[model samples]
Each structure stands twice: as structure tokens, then as C-alpha cells.
Target: MSATDLTSAAEGHGTGSSVGTTDLIDVEATDFMPDDSVAGAAADLPAADVAVRAQQLTKRYGNLLAVNQLDLVVPRGSVFGLIGPNGAGKSTTFAMMASLLRPTSGRIIVMGADPSKKPRTVRRRMGYMPDNLGVYDNLRVDEYIEFFAASYGIHRSEWTALVDGLLELVDLSVKRSAMVNSLSRGMKQRLSLARALVHDPELLILDEPASGLDPRARVELRELLKTLNGMGKTIVISSHILAELEEMCTDIAIMEAGKLLAAGPPREILERLGGARTVKVRFATGISETFTVADDAEQAALLRRLLVDEGRDVVEFVEHSGGLEQLFMTITEGVVQ
Candidate 1:
């Protein structure tokens, strides 16, 4: 690909019998700070501080624990991701963060407000696009967006313009007159996203926003998400599709069986999962297991130090972060659920 060409991917699947988890590593608080380029100016940077933070978040149902001491932090103007198989507590986590489910334990701060005690404030600041988006089937697209605008106490005069703008933002302006029920599955998903944006919320909690969409529709929605990020919207999304999330998120968290397995910038996660990068070896004729090293860095490095002979002359010594999928596989042998 060209330098200008960029790609990302999601990292999850529906729950299966056994839960799969990626590797986990501790990140210094410094990891969350904006670098020099990001700290330059408002026109050039997104929000300056943390938009969401979780400390030892936990939740339970009867005797079964739904969420473990999970920790997460999301910065403004970034697309953060959560991935895992079904029953991994991914949806439950989003709900608790959105104030829909009160966690049994742990602390959650969304946009600087505690959802536990001040759900209204948190909800007002957030636009949640849950998996089940029950839009008023009778209302036209424009009317649907307007209805939400009204509920938010927007003035009638401002409603039309805001609705128009939101429609355009979600790329559904052309469908303004169509009945909400008339839109295709993808269109409805986009419309729901539009509804979420109607209030011009600061934070967006999107649970499977791309679920059930055709390829074309999924691409369009991804593009819209990219635009939202460029416009400085802090978004948190959950998806079983690891490829999609990898494409859009700057940072991500991998969950399994109610616990966070890995969380950090993509490269950091990949490194901790087992690879520093990638290493390839070449031999004149062929070398057997002589060159093979364990995935663990310390063990591999120690072997290399002792086993490598100057006579053999290592043909290849390459180092690079492995692909997300490869890293994920190296860390866990089973399905993510």
C-alpha cells in the first residue's frame, strides 16, 4: 500500500463455548498523554484530557460474575474499541458505562460524570446506539431525528436545521422524506446513528453499530465514523468483527469471559501478545528446528545468545510487530467467547 493508504480492523466474534482472550500488559499513565503533535493547537488537536476512565470496574449476576476488575480509559476525539465473543460481557460493559446497568463494583466516569449517581448528566452527554435500535417506524427519517431533537429540548426553529445537519452527517439527508420503516437494514442503522448524533453529544457509546449491514453499508458507516473522529467526537464501539475495529480504532481493548485480556494502542497490544515485530530467517540450504525460538522474548533472546554459532551466519534477523490476527492467535488458542 501507498504511504497515504491506511487500514484498520476489528477484533471479536460472538461467544462460543470456550472464551478466548488476547494478552494483557500494564501501560503507564504517560501512555494516555498527548504527544507533541497532538498538543500543539485546538484547530489541530482533539480534547486535551481524558473523556472516559474506569477503575477496577466489576459487575455480577447472581453467583456468576459478569465483569471483572476491568480497567479502561478513552481519550477525546479517538475511536476506542472493545472486542470479544458473545457472552464475553462486552455488551454488559457498554451498558454499565452508559448507565443502563449499574455495575456491582468498580468505578466508571464518563465525560467526567459518574453514571452511577448522575445517569441523566452522563446520558445527556452521550449518544448510545445499542444493538436493538427501535426507531419509530411511522416517522419519516427527518421526523425521527426531529423527534429526538425535541426530546432534548431543542427549539422548533433549530430542530429542522439540526435534523438536516445530522442527516447529512450520517449521509442520510437524501432519505429525509422516507419513512423510517422504508429504509433498508443498513439505512436504518445509519438513521439510528443519525438519531444518536441529533443531540450533538460529546460521547458516543455504539454497540454493534455495523451489525446486520451489507458490505457497502458497512463501508459507508465506517467512513461516517472516520468523519466523526476527524470532527473530534469521542466514540466507544463494540463489535465481534475484529477486522472492522482494527480499521477504525486508534486504541482498543480485548475482552473475554468478563475480563479484559489486552488494552492499549494497537502496536503495544501486538507486542505484549508475543511479537516485537516480525522476524524472518533464511538459510543457504535449510536449517531445521535449530533456528526456532519460543515466542516469549526473554527465552528466545537467551537461546539466540547461546545457540547461534558464528559459522552458521544467521541469514535473516528481522523484527517487526506481527499482524493483529497473528498476535491474537499467538496469545490464545481458542475462540474469544
Candidate 2:
């Protein structure tokens, strides 16, 4: 089908970090964000143009296997999401991918290079922000960004324009003179992001980058991510916040017991959850068990139209496409050792 005729698809991104109004992608695009539909898949990403590739990537710490033979791909320029329950090897896998932790076996190739063997080379082209990624307590926002810039050996003449430009992009320009330790947790998160963009690396691996942000802060961070995505930056964000992830990612990998339980577009995964689509039919009273609709398209459409056309006392009507949160709860619930 043609791109426009389809339900959802990637719109071309703009120059600044945020995507324009046309590209508010939804769906299971990734763990952190889902597109409106499966193929609303970003057109900018090259097919199989993997920025991060791990196969049978296992990490065994003594007798404990943190990551068990996991395999996945993040297409170049795609904002991918990596999700799992708490302690589901999400951080461990991120460590392995970022070359922060050594693996017991298996292979990992990121951006055409083996990070384990050529870490410095790989790191030059990649940025990493761990769940607790830290900032310099003594440095001001500008100085913090400038420090990473200098570390990258950015040109002296260019660093000023570049650092200031990025700080503004992340909305931290006002805080440029503020000491790192003085900023709130959310502000520090933004600073961490600014540091990651210092070199304009080809790939970004952010672990729960929005973890503790307040609602407004989280929304701003989400918008910033969309902007970077529009600029063709490749991203792999790991999070357990399925609702937030639902807003931004294009492709997703759900992990349990150190293995990928499901890997596909978000919408498809929900469809695979089986049974009558969980439709929440709101009325004056809670939906009674006695109230049931037949499992047929006509019945489904009628229910939908009734809600849409009449705007009845229907408080909500989310057809239970078992969402990512539900899926995560299913796979990881009580599964952690």
C-alpha cells in the first residue's frame, strides 16, 4: 500500500533535535517508543542498516548468567527500545553493548566494529548514558558539556558553537552557568544527554534516561528524543516504563530470563496476545460480566461506532490489545530469580 494511505508511517525529520508535528510516531516502534503502526517504521533508516547487533550475546558472572544468548538488531537511524522487567538483564545487556562489561561468550558488532576488541574505536562513534550516569559535581552545565567536547578532541574554535548549540537543543542553555550538583535530578539527566551528544556519535545507548523526571520534564525529554531521531540519529533506549516507551520507539525487543521473549513491531505483538480484543466499554456503571459482545468484526465495529458516533457515557474504550506493559508483566512477572 502507498505510504500515505497506510495508517501510520515515518515523516521526514527536521534539522533541530525534535521532529516536526508530522512525525509523532506511535506503535511498538521500539521499547521506548511505538509507531502508530508497524510500517510507520521510519523511512530514514536503511534496511538492516544495523547500528547495534548482538547475537547469542551472553554474559555469565561466575555461575550466574545475566544475559542468556540474546540476539537483536537496531537499524541505523531507528529509535529502538530495549525493555524488560527489573533485573531482566536490561542493564547488563546495555553494558555489553556499550563495552562497559565483558561478556563470557557470543559476539557483538556495533556500527560495523566489534566493541569488545576495538573499544576505543567503537566508543568514538557511540554514546552511552547508564541508568545512573553521573555528571561532574563541580562543573557548570556549559563546562560539563565542554569537558566532554574537549575529551572528544573537538576543535577549540568549533567547540564553543557546538557545545552551546547542543545545550540549547536540550533546553539546558538557561542552566549553563548552574553547577551540576545544584541542578535537580531531571536537569542532570538532560546534562547527561548533552554530554552524550558532544561528539555527535553515530549511535546513542541511553539506559532509563527519563527514569526520574517529573511529567513535564519527561515530556520535554521525549520531545528532544523525537528531534534527535528526526536528525537521523540512531538510538537504543532501555526502560521498564512501558507507557513512556509506548510513545516514542519504532522497534522493540522484550526480554525475559535473559532471552528475547518477543521481537517485532509493538502493534503486532499486542495483536498476538490472543482472544477478543480487550475493549473497555464504559457505561454509567462498571462493565458487568453479564455484558459481553460476540467476537465478530461487525460486533466490534458496532461497539466502536456506538462510542464514536454517539459519544455515550463511555468513559473509555481501549480494545485490549495487550499492551507492552501487559506483555512485560506477563513475561517477567514472578520470573526473576
Candidate 3:
């Protein structure tokens, strides 16, 4: 049960660079422009580290409540996961945060500006990739990216260099001249992501980004997101696939039937929901022991006592953990309103 042995034993774990703008890019501050609306609202951001906050956020459709009295806060420079079963109001909440839908009652503050009040400011600061992304089949990859960069009001002088850099970031540089329709599902998904980043927004609201991707594609997407996060972008992602989120997210929020069931780091939510995790200890003699613990500290302390106090020859000490899936099930009733 030595530290090195424990490190080798606990192997049940699951899963950064900057690009400089070259002189060939040759862009002044004015060369890289945002929309007029964005420019006007950019100066009005309140000084705050809270990237997004929802106060009693609710949305109703006639007699049906899509989201009910939900409160959420997302900090800057974090990869956040928003998860729920079908009809759990995740999409509704995302819509409100993205300024695509108005709330029935409540407020959404994104990047220190209320999206409803100053949507322009939020738009300039946030990049949203919906679950169902549309692609212009006729447009080439570079053309598609250029279209969005221009829509964000990037000046003509910077479009070529900007689009090129974004394509490289998404691993689509070689496909730049390829037609959008000619690409596979995975390639198209990556292209959509490149489109989202064209604006150089600080926050990315991504819905089901890995929906139909193959295993390799999903891994690639996850790595790309991590790179973006390393470069200081706060990303809010939603997906039905719990395991994927469990691996990539820094924090998560769960919802059921339009109500937030839990929100926080995965471990905190798991503990709050009374989720129990087990520790598996194997001795050199082929004997094993299992102990259930409420938290990591407890598990660590137990291991120490077993090794030091009892002088046990521990060969393996694996944390048979309860992850995000366990916490999601523990907190949600699976009822769809």
C-alpha cells in the first residue's frame, strides 16, 4: 500500500498550445471587427467572473412549464455540462441563455449582461452550437467558415487569415477547399464547430456536439474542446451521453422535467445525492477487500491505516467510483413533464 504501488494500482481512470497570429496575417485591431451592435454593447459589461447566471429561470408554453424556477451559475474558464433526459428543459434553458428564446419569467445574465436586454453583447461574447446544426452543402469548407466570420462582422482584410486559423484549430485545414456536402458526418461536425468559433467568442454553448460521432471523432472533439478551454474559453455543453460528459466536464448540472435536480462538481453532487463509492484493495496473497466511502479523503485515510497501522501488503487499491451517471440517476425521477 505504498504511494507508488497505490498509484500503479489505481489505474481505473478515464480521460495545450497557443497559436500566434503571424505577420503574414497582418491585422490591426480594426482589421478584426465585430458587428456594430456588438461594438456598441461591448463596453457595457459589468466587471464579474461569473460568466452566466440564471435567477429563478423559467419558461412556460401555455399550461406546460418547460423549465421551472431554476437557478444556475457558471464561472468563467470552465467546461460545464448541462444534462437531462428528453423534455427535461435543457434545450429550453439553453435557448434562453443563447438569446434565441425569451423566458416566460426570470432573467438570464450572460457575460455580465442580461441577454434579453443586451443580446448584442451576449452574441459578441458567446458562441452557440445547437444540437441540429445546418450546413451549406454547396459551400466549400473555407467558404462556410468565411461566411460566419463575415457575419460576425470581421473585416475583409482579416477574413482569409482568420478562417485559415480557425480551420487549423478544428483540424480541418486540409479540408478547407473541400465541399461541405462531400464531408462525412464527423468532418461536418468539426466544421460546424469551426463555424461557431469564427466570432472568437469567450463562451461556447454547445448542444449535443458528439451526438452521431464515431468513437474516434468523439475523442477528437473532446480534445479540441480541451484545447479551447486551455486557451481560456468557457464552454457550456449538453449531451444525452452521460459518460462523455463525465470524462470531459469540469462541472455539471442535471435536470428532470423542467426542474434542476442538481448542480456542481460531479463529486459534490454525488455526495449530496447519497451516492456511495467503493474502494477495492488487493493484497499480494490474492485476497481483496472492499470498503464503501462517502468521499475521497475517507478512502485515502482508510488505505493509510490499512497499510501503515495493519502492515498489510497491498498490491492494488482501486477506487471503484460512482461517476456522473450514478449521480444523475440518483437525483432525477425520470418523469417528463
Candidate 4:
């Protein structure tokens, strides 16, 4: 459970639902396309049922370009992950998407409302949790969520059940009366998550929501998010923990030095980046064989023939696909903007 051992963490934690790699790339390329046309390199991709679309989205701080004409589209009802190295414009992108920071140039369509033109409209439909979330030390967990809910303009009549349900959803129901500062880091992280869900927004923009949590806490967080997604909430999350995102995210966008390296489902990105799948054949004679194949169908066909026609004593046949971290390394050169 070492905080730095994210590789092992990714392997240990599993999503509640099974995510198949087959046709994932094509699905992302087609279904997750932007709703409107984008300028620059992203102009060619088609549009679909997008929850958020950024067309030539850019942000510049003086001379530094924090986000460079980034074209991104998150499909509705998806758990989308935004991944990158340090200073990879992830935070900046989140800010613009949440309508917190003004983009120097470009358009951001959040749930069909332009954040720049209709900030209030977009704000009502989205809930944002920054990486450095601050808590009121004196306020109790229930009070904290209540404060935000009120601020979001929720009716007082619905407060009781709304707060209770959100607390239970994040596994903080027992800590409702506890002071925010008295809670552990994991509890506080969950509390922040509850705070974001207070308004019942259509989209949740989370910046490193699991940043300070331990391994076990991270698993709990993942399960909670899966439940939320199953309830029809669209989530856009950014984290250094690639493995967790690899399992939880339906699709991903990889950025480096304020530039996009790739965007799509992990399997699609891996396939396009020349990532090969591994086939392991274990024989009954205590011997095993492994093959790296480009085409899984062809490999499976050959393996079946050897097992059935040639009468090979095969006990187990397993295929290992490349991981998200591997795909990230291959796509980006780790360059800084």
C-alpha cells in the first residue's frame, strides 16, 4: 500500500464491472466524438453524444501556453480520465471546463452550454472539485455538505434526504456529526467528493480526487465512483494514478507539456500505438508457451488449431493486454511545456 507504488495499486484494484478491450478504440473514435467542429488538428474527428466538447481550447499564462489548442470530448454517462505528467495542462483544462478560468482563445461546450457565454448555466449542470480542496475545520461533515448545497441553491425541503444519500454514497454517513478537520485524510477526501455531489450535477469534474488516500481508501473511492457512474453521472477525473484510471475510465485523454499526445479508449490508444497483446498457453506437461501477437483473432485461431487439430495438451490460454501506463509512455516523450 505504498503511496509511490501506483503500478502495484493498479494491478490490485479491480472495477466492479467488466470492461472489454474489443472494439473499444472504434467506440471511442466514433461515439465519443465532439458535438461541434474543432479547429486545428482535432478538426477531422466526427461529433456524437458529447457531454463536454472543447474546440481549439487553449489557455496561455503570459508567454507560456498552458493548454495548446486541446480538442476533447467526453461522452455522456461516461467515466472519463484525463492523464499526463506534471504541468501537463490537466488542471488548466479542468479549470476551463468548470468555467473557473477564462480561456485565452477557444470554445468550451459544457452540456451544450458555453462556459464562457453562459457561465451560470454551465455551473448549474456541473460540480467541480479542485485538487487542493479546502475544508472548514469547524464545520461538521453534514454541515459542510449542507453549506455547499445551499450555495448551489437546492431547496431546503430536499436537503435532508439529499445530504443523507450523498453521505452514504461516499461512505461518510457515520461521520456526519464529526468535524471536518477531525476526519482522516481518506474521510476528508470522501467528504470532498460528497461536497461535489451535493447539487446533483450532470457532470463531475474531479482533479486528483484520490490524491492523498492510501491503497485501501483508493479502492473504496473507486467503488463509490463506479456506483455514481452506474446512477447516470458523467465523471471527468485527472490523476497521477494511471492504473486506477485504467480500470475505472471508459475513455481517456493523454496530454504532455500542454499538448495532446492521444485521446481515446485505452485499448484503442494501445492498438494505434503498436501495442501488442500477449498470449500465454500452459500445457499439461508443466510447460508453457507465450506469443506476442498483433491480431488477437488470428492468434486465437492458430492456438485453437494447435489444441484441437494437432492434439496439443493445453490446460489454460490467457491473453494479456498492455496497460495504461505502458500506453502513456509510448505515446508521449515526457516533454514539459
Candidate 5:
């Protein structure tokens, strides 16, 4: 039940196999034809400025409105993180952008193509790694990567080198011959990432990628993602790990109850949302004071008044900006839908 099964079935590589509901929910199936109308409209956008744009996107499951009029834009070549609590519809939003699910209302443009109308075009340019690894059973690590490579229509001769490069990229070259089921959770997560990159996509959509990794594995994943972003790939990631996201993401969107609470560069959002910066000052006279400022200008004015105007013997001055965890706690009311 690997993600390759969904790719193979969707891309016409499999015969008439049936995919389970759980598999369908977690994996991306991309084999639909393109629509010229949607393609032409998407082409009107400035491709360099945006990678993914959603205009009032909505999704409903019968009586449940999973995603509600969520509007978002991910700039190209940026690491965008989606933050939300459980039942926040982040996964639903990702599924729509990946072309695995159609929106109940509104429009979504991914890589300048409408995923609902031009799924093939969108899917070919994007790679998706879900939270669950699915079932790998007896497949070897190399075999698993090769399976996805073939599913993406890569030549059989090129698979050896491709698999080698991907395994090395995920630091799993030594486990190339080991059974996928025998690997630990972290190793399987890395393997799944390799599977997603088999086609060398321009965009990567990762959901809870660091869900079960150890601290070392999480650090490795963060560095690897930064490397990929440096290589000009736009990454959209969703995680409850706010600290990691704060360190790695260039832009972030916070969602709650299927609604966007904030979206932009972290600093800009912090400034706009009235996030305060704490300044600590120590004097040579064994006296210390702490002040909270709203922005850099205020922080600078305070420093100037103390050192120049007051003529005080300031020994140390340090400023601390609020972190993403604080922002999340401040903005979200713990509401789950």
C-alpha cells in the first residue's frame, strides 16, 4: 500500500486495482488530462511571483465543512509552513492543492495550473509525502524507490542511478538492500521522502514529515528541506512542530477551524499582530531593566535614549523576538472542528 500504488494506478501503470479509502486519503493519484481553458487562465499569472494560489477555496464532506473559504498564496522558491491544531483542515487543503481532491467551491492554482482541471500538469510539477507511510511489506528500499521512478515513467535503465542518488540524498544508501518494513519510523519517513522525489519535481508538498522522527532525524530533515529550497524548489509543509517551522520557513500560514488566522513572513505577521519584542538592559551600577517594544524603531529609540540621552553606563543590551509557539498560542483559541 505504498504511495507508489496510488501513483501507478492513477498513471495507468496498474491494471484495474482498487485503492482503499485510507490510501486514497493519504496518497496522491495523478493521471487526469489537462483542460485548455484552465491552463490558459493559469498562464495569465506571473509564474515567478507565485507557486500556489487559492481563491476562496472550500471543501465539504457532507455536513462537515472541512475547509472554509481559505485563501492563500505561496511565493515561488519559498519554504511555506502551514500551522494548525487537529481538525484544522490543513490536510484537506493540501489534498486539493496536490490534485488528489476536488474543492467543493472556489478555485486553486498550483504551479500556474488549476489542479482540478489540469491535474497532470500540476502533479508532474509537484511531489507529495503524506504523514502515513502506508504498507511496504517485503519491498526493499531500492525496490521501493525504483517502483516510484517507474511509476513516474522514468526509464528502467535510469532507475539504478536515480535510486542511488535519492537513497544518498536521504542518507539511506547503506540500507538499500534492507526490507522497507524492517526500517524504523524515521528511516521509513526518509524513504517516503525519497519516493516523493523520484521524479525531481519543482514543488514538494509535505504533511507532518517530522511526525515520528528523533531529534537528530528532525534536524536532518530540516537541513535537507533547506537544501532543497536553496536548489529553487518551492516547499509547502504542514506540521505541529512550530519551533522547527519557525527556524526553517521563510513564510507561514496559521489556520484554525478551516480559517486562515494569519499568512505572511513570520516577522511581518508578528509585527502586524502586535507581537512585542523584549529588550533587556544592564548597567555597570548593578541595575537591570527590561522593556517591551512593539517594533524595531521603538527598540532602537529606547537604546538611544539610554546610551546617549540618559548617559548611563549600559553594560549589556539584548533583544528577544517572540517565537512561533507564542504566536500560535496567542492567536488560536484551541478551537477544533
Candidate 6:
């Protein structure tokens, strides 16, 4: 999508006319001066340690409650994953955090300021990538990126280098002159990500970024996210790809029916939920046995019993823990709202 499309989407266009590009760019040019009273109150809160915090956050679409009283915190410099089945309210929660949607009740702070009350503050410090990407007819990739850089009020003199760097960062340097509409779905996804990074925001909120990506593309995206996190950008991502999230996320939260089911480091949740580990043993006599152990202690005791207590000739002993996928299945009841 072009920068204009992004602006419209970011402002919640379904309820009203889309924000004009001129007005959005003009707003970007001026420094946002927040109300002193609001700023003063925010200053006293503990916002430095966390990038996002929601307390009793709720959102309703008329009679349908999209997000229940949800409470979540995303620590600074962490890759946090939000996972849920369809209708679990992950996207609704993300929209509220990105300041694109207002809550029916409750409050959320992004980068230390209330997003609904201080959207510009939150937006300036954050970048957002939605799941779907809209095509811009006849717009070249470089021009697409430059449009967003201009929208962010970056000086015209810096456009060339900024565009070059961004294209390279997303591995689209070869497609610099390619039309946005001509690019593949994966390429467009990467371009959308580059558009989000134009302003070098400290925080990124991505919803289903790997939806249309191939296996290779997904791996590239994962590595790129890790590189960005290493560079000090806090990322909040939602994906149905549980295995990928298990590999890259430092923390994860599972949601169902607009309510949080579990939240924390993945291993902690696994242990807390009694996610068992599987042990496979092979004997020199060609006998094989499988055992289920709850935790590391049990696995250790099982190994000792095989080698010492039973005095069996253990040829091979391997242990495997059910990662995020198993933990997710164990915790969520396949609930949908």
C-alpha cells in the first residue's frame, strides 16, 4: 500500500472519510505539543520500562464485545507474540494499541502516553503493519517508500539515501524501480514493513505479517525482526504460525474469545501448564521404551533409573518437549467468539 493508504487505515476510515495526505503530511511537519497536565501526569507513571501496557482494556462493536477486559504488558526491547484462534480479538487489541480504534472502556498506554488521548505521540514513536496490503497502481517501490518518508516530514535532500537504505533493508533493492502492483504478495509484505520503518520508530506493532509469505520469505522476515530487535526496537507481533513464534519470541500471550488465557515467557507457561516432556530410550538389546515426564527433574530421574537402578544397556536416550504449539493446544479450549 502507498503511504496515503496507510494514513487512512491508521485513522480508522470505516467510520468517516479517510485522512487526506496533505493534512497528514502537514501534521507530521509540526512538532506535537502535548497538554502539560497530561504530560505531567504521564511523567509520574512507570512507562520507561515497558513499551505498552493495557489495564482492563475493552472494545465493543455494538452488541459484540470484540475485546474483553484485557490486561497486557510488552516490555521494552522484547519480541512479544500475541496468538489466538480466529475471533480471539488479537487484531482488535492491536488496533487499540496503534491508536486506530478507541476502547469502549478501560485504558492503554503506548510509549508512556494514552494512545486515544495522545495518538500523535504514540504514532510518532511507533510503526504499524496491518495483515493485508493494498496495491498502488503505477507507483514504483522506491517512490512508495519515498512517499512515506515525505509523509514523516523527512527532508527532501535525504530521500535518495533513505529510500536506498530502506529498500536494501527489506531486500528490495533489485525491485527499486518495480511497480508496487507488479510485485508479488511477499514482496509487497516486505515493502509494507519498509514503509513502517521509514520513520525509524522505536516500537513496531505487526499483525499477521507472515500471512502470505512462503517458507523462505518467512525465515527472512524472522531474521529481519531479530535484527531490528537487536537494534533496540520493541516489536509486538501476532501470528498463527506457532512454531515460528516459539523460535523468535521472548514472551508470548495466548488469547481466546477476547480474553487472555495465558501470558508470560513460553517455557514458564509450559511448566505451569504441566506440559510434559517425552523421552525415548533405545537399548543395545534392540528394545525401545518411551516415557512421559512432566519436567526436567522427572526426566533426570527417569534417565538415572534406566542407567543405574534398572542396570539396562541404554544405547540412546533422547528427550523432547512440546514447544509453543503443544502448549497452545493444551491451554486454549478452541473457543471462538
The prediction achieving the highest lDDT against the true structure is 5
Local distance difference test values of all predictions, in order: 0.68, 0.69, 0.75, 0.77, 0.79, 0.78
lDDT of 3 by residue, 57-89 (tens): 899999999999877767567788999999999
- Model 5 TM-score? 0.85
Q: Candidate 3: worst 10 consecutive residues by lDDT?
A: 24-33
In what order do the candidates fall by lDDT, top score first? 5, 6, 4, 3, 2, 1
Give TM-scores for every candidate, taking all chains together and pairing residue i with residue i: 0.74, 0.77, 0.84, 0.84, 0.85, 0.84
Taking all chains together, the TM-score of candidate 4 against the true structure is 0.84
lDDT of 1 at 206: 96
On lDDT, the stronger of 1 and 5 is 5
Model 2 RMSD in angstroms:
8.8
Clashes of each: 21, 24, 0, 0, 0, 0
lDDT winner between 3 and 4, please give it: 4
For residue 48, give model 4's deviation from the true position in Å: 7.5
Ranked by TM-score, the better of candidates 1 and 4 is 4
- Give, for candidate 5, the lowest lDDT window spanning 10 residues: 18-27
Lowest summed lDDT window (length 10), candidate 4? 1-10
Least accurate 10 contiguous residues by lDDT in model 2:
1-10
Model 5, position 298: C-alpha lDDT score: 95
Off by over 4 Å in 2: 1-48, 280-318
Off by over 4 Å in 1: 1-48, 276-322, 332-337
As for lDDT, the candidate ahead, 5 or 6, is 5
Instruction: At residue 202, give the lDDT of candidate 2.
Output: 67
